[model samples]
Target chain A: MGKTMSEKIFERKVNHAVQPGDLVIAPIDCAMGQDGTTPLAIKSFLDMNAQSVFDHHKIFFVIDHNAPSPMESVSRLHDEMRSFAQKFGISLFDVGQGVCHELMVAKGLVVPGDLVVGADSHTCTYGALGAFATGIGSTELAVAMISGKLWFKVPETIRINLHGTLQEGVFAKDVILFIASQLKADGANYKAIEFHGPVIDRLEMDERFTISNMAVEMGAKAGLMVPDDKTFSWVKKRSKRDFESVFPDPNARYCEVVDLDCSFLTPQVALPHRVDTVKSVEELDEIPIQEAFIGTCTNGRIRDLEVATRILSGRKVHPHVRLIVAPASREIFLHALQMGWVEEIVQAGGVFVTPGCGPCVGTHQGIPGDGWNVISTANRNFKGRMGNASAFIYLASPATVAASAIEGKITDPRKYLR
Target chain B: MSWRGYAHKFGDDINTDYIISGKHKFKTLDMNELAKHVMEDIDPNFYQKIKPGDFIVAGKNFGCGSSREQAPRALLAAGIRGVLALSFARIFFRNAINCGLLVLECNTSPIQNGDEMEIDLLVGKIYDHTQGVQIEARPLPQVMIDILQEGGLVNYFKKYGSFRGV
Candidate 1:
């Protein structure tokens, strides 16, 4: 049988042909732990009585989730992380560096065909570059740090072929939300999801990252797209790292095949408390929103900011709603600033937060109040996710969020777009 | 590999956010302190109610959302014996196992709250002493069982030096 993309990645890691269900301790190309999970990993690594990290250069520690050290306690964690990084000579990204997933790709730390692991679930975002990446626990990260290898049960691949073209108003966020609606939260549990077909070819690098970033919402181990000319060219601008393009064979065995037609898709939103509870933007009741956020590893790229800016340039945000804009990384932040997107966003009454996780993780900066309603472009809408259990969070595309911020309600982006 | 405890039953989609609220995140690294606030948002009395050596039985998608290892570590610190659910998110499953916490998959609806339950890891059987019934659960693979036997991956690594099987 022909090998799936996941199988191909694993085969290279193990240095042998492997099939689904095979458990192998494969060498990892990169290992990461963000601020929220790194402290624990450091403790575990010490608890294991390890003398030093297996590969100092290959491991990364990012301080993005609670950057600026929201509190003294969080600052202490950062202090410990700094100490750990210094002692082992590992790369450490301090506050304002941006989210780890974004920084990893922006810095060209992750290349195609690499097996990457992180302590944060959204680490799967790296797969947008065709890398086989997944999230594990802090303890597992500790083990990988010590040995540079960990065990993985090679998962069966599920083919999700996206056909047709996305309408102007429908963003990559909408496409992922629609897919999650069909797959439910646990639909792809323990499986590798591979996106193919013509629609994928048209998606930009940032758009591809947005889709792969949410694949974990449906329980996918990894979400990947084949690296084509666009990928090569975009990555070329960032780094000259030599990476072999990996793709699935034509006859690859698939556990299931799901075909998504992008032509009929509309702007989508996920309601309160569950990502899978998705609906078309027009079908929702007229809900008033108190806050609108536009940033995260999912939709915090320059392209996403441009979309929000393009819609908000000539309009002012409703006086009742607070719009917060966060860039994914320092590089993206500067890029957006230079391109005048930040000026347009601010003129529209959008509050620009630091280039870190910020409200996306509920750490600080623009947390919602009791019983308040929020429209955000970030992934996940679980209860109390924004630091208030009584508050409601709605997930939508950046365009939709920008439009709703202007109307003070859940307004569809298509209505405001030119 | 066997465990016996009272059932602490919960409903479906009991996400990691509810297991240990984000409010507590980065507040402290002490798992014991974290255990004191486990499930504080969902059930305010959860920490006070749960005793050491208790088992959590829940519906589908237990420990879903956010790949925080604290979710599993908090339970372990609180002395939870194991978790039995219809299913689990992939990351949580790995986290729980890495923490030396037992996670089994089975239809947990029939397991009532406060029921005395015993699980035989070797036999893949769950015996409800309170209900006088037995449910067959999918057994863990040998690799997982061995890891649990070694008291999680850290200990396993300590004992064996490096992981086997490339």
Candidate 2:
């Protein structure tokens, strides 16, 4: 009853505690920017008479959506962003070292218990590190850029406790997709989610990120994880900058706590129209996949590729299916190369693309033609979220996607897991 | 918070991109400049010019994408006095109040454009400002009404910083 993770987080880095009906100004620990929205945010800041950023140290920018390939206008936008960062002294992640959320995790920009606001909705991904991170509009982002403060309504939180070990071949993506299917997109409307359980301890940083990344698909403001050894070690290694550990008080009370027997979860996928339209791979009959893309902030990680490579070692993509593999980051790309997963993916008659937000935003690469049925590794499969509004994007775990890519349809990943 | 403008009606699920496209997401570009082309993507003539004091009626998830405070900034600047939606996207709802834009969440959907609305923002009612037009919408919670009355969350904080750590 005293404090939840949300209250505790606000209590620390903020100027004060967050009570009902109380509006407080808190210093933003990290401000994330991406190419699609950051340029406009910076432009608005300039228009508002902000000569320089209030504090560059707290600001961060990344060019994730259109990286590795800079179309003319896109290149200009990047240049504009570079100039904005230079003018305001904000550190820019131009190389797009990784997906913005993954990059923030890897770069140590987000620490457990830090309050982060990102121009992109997925900024809520940092809540995986135990921070109260939320997404904001570019206009509000600009305000945060100049004022270092914004207002928030303390969202009602629903706590999910994962109690058992995960089934093999079922990674964090499946766990989240299953959760979304249960909650339905609007079930948790205007709520914050705190994910806790024993299984969370085993998930890698990127895996935890994948869980928190898709939280927005459930209509949640953010998804949070409590600080653990993973949080401490991650902050120490990446941030190289010192950070304090924050947690919910021992007697904290949650509005509701939903317990899960993760061992009960299998490879899951969201059909169409909503992330909540969940169906297990085995439940569907003869569902042929037109395409399979394995990457995004959701499942684009070293482990994801490693699991996929094992499944695709000697197999070729179905003659009718086009399979695309994108590493989550340059670091992951280089790591994949060294580990031979890159070669495995290529030898399987699949296309391995660059490390950016391509298929996810339907921008750079992997464009889905109309009526295309794509089982993707990205977050949302909302109507028209991909290429054509009519294109049916089904969200799934990397393993399920890999198995389906081989079978040319949605197949249960358990066939290959053992 | 003084309610001055007339009402404009629009259905919900009005995304930020719909409010202002990604390409046009720059600040200091006031609402009048933005409202000029409001819904140009959806309806090319929406913002050529609009009535004052009109409200936007949204179906569900109004202001759903990009947490940029600009969506409401442009709407409020353009001509909208308040937004009445069956539901509101969480972030946008916060930003609207924080930035002093009025957003009212009303249940009972299917808001038609022709239904003229009279909104009592203080009381959280959206009666047909138009005579002979009857529409249904749920009023807001009292706590939300109070926050709005103080001219947005920040102003409320300024007057009573007690609820938050100041």
Candidate 3:
């Protein structure tokens, strides 16, 4: 049988062929943990009575969540992370550096054909570069850090073919949301999804990152895209290391194949508390929002900011709504600043915060008040995701969030786009 | 091995945030302290109601959001013996196994809140004492059983010096 991309990647690691449902131990090329989970991982590393990490350069610790220390307790955790990283000489991305997954890709730590693991669920974001990345628990991270290897139960691949061009005002976020609504929350549990066809080919690397990042939201082990020139160009600009890309054979067997036509797709929004509860922008009643946020590992790239800035260029944020813009990384923030996207957004009444996770993880930065409704471009809208259980969060594209901020309600972005 | 517990039933897509709210994730990493507020968002009296050896029974996609280990750690600290669900999020399943928390994939429809239940790991059976029905669950792999026997991955590592059995 022809091998899928996942099987091919594992075969290279194990020096033997692997099939779905096969359990094998493979060496990890890169591993990462953020402040929220790294402290626990550090504790587990110590509890294991391990002396030192297998490789200092391969492991990374980032302090993006609760950056700048929301309180003394969080500050203590950050300090613990710093001390641990320093003692082991592991790479540490301190506060204001950006989200871990973004840094890993932007800094050249992850490349095609690498088996990357992170303590955060969105670590699957690196799959945009053809790397097989997945999230694990802190203890697993500790184990990987100490031993430099982890076991995996090879997941069957699900091929999704996207054929049509996206409609105006729709984006990669909308495409993924539409897929999520069809698949539901656990539709792809423990399975690898390979995105193919024209729509995926036309998408930029940043947009591909957004799609792969939300793969875990549907319970996928990894969301992989075949690396092409766009991927090579992006990785080449950022990474000095050579990498070999993996591709699925045309005759490879898939557990399931799904075809989606993006031509008729509209602006999609995931309602409060459930990512799968999606609706097109026009289908919803006028729901007022108190906050509109445009940032996170999911949609905080330069392209996302450009969309937000274009929509808000000659408009002002509604007096009642607060618009917060946070870049995924300091590099993106600097780039946005140089391009005047930051100043234009600010002039339009949007607030700029440090380039970190922002209020996406509910750690700090812009936690919504009680009963407030927030329209955000970040992934995951589970209850209490924004630091207030009573506050409602609606997940949408950056364009939708920008238009919503201007209207102080859930407004269709097409009108603003036109 | 056998376990007896009362089921605390939940619905589909019970995310990790509902298990242990994000508001409390950074408040403290102390599992015991976090356990006090476990499932409080879903049921305010959950912490007070659940006794040691109780089990959380839910429909599809339990523990679905965020890869935070605290979600499982909080449950383990709150004396939850195991979780019986129709399915689980991938990361949460691994996290539970690493934390030595028992998670079984079975038909949780027959299990209700306050129902007395018994699970036999060896036979992969769930006996609902309240309903007087037996549900067969998918048996866990021997490697997972070995890890659970050691009380989690950390213990497994300490005992074997590597991920040998796994």
Best by DockQ: 3
TM-score of chain B of each: 0.95, 0.76, 0.96
RMSD of 1: 1.2
User: Which prediction has more favorable TM-score, 2 or 3?
Assistant: 3
In model 2 chain A, the worst 10-residue window by lDDT is: A15-24
DockQ of each: 0.74, 0.25, 0.81
lDDT of 3 by residue, A137-234 (tens): 99999999999999999999999999899988899999999999988899899999999999999999999999999998899999999999999999
On lDDT, the leading prediction is 3
Candidate 2 lDDT, tens digit per residue, A172-250? 9888988887776655667889898888888888789889887877668889988888778878888876666667666
Computed on alpha carbons, the lDDT of every model, listed in order, comes to 0.90, 0.74, 0.92
Q: Which residue runs does candidate 3 get wrong by more than 4 Å?
A: none
Candidates ranked, most accurate by lDDT first: 3, 1, 2
lDDT score for residue A167 of model 1: 88
Identify the runs in model 2 with alpha carbons over 4 angstroms from their true place: A68-70, B1-56, B65-82, B95-102, B110-113, B129-166
Per-residue alpha-carbon lDDT of candidate 1 for residues B42-116, written as tens digits (9 for 90 to 100) = 788888878788999999889888999999999999889799999999899988887889899997877899999
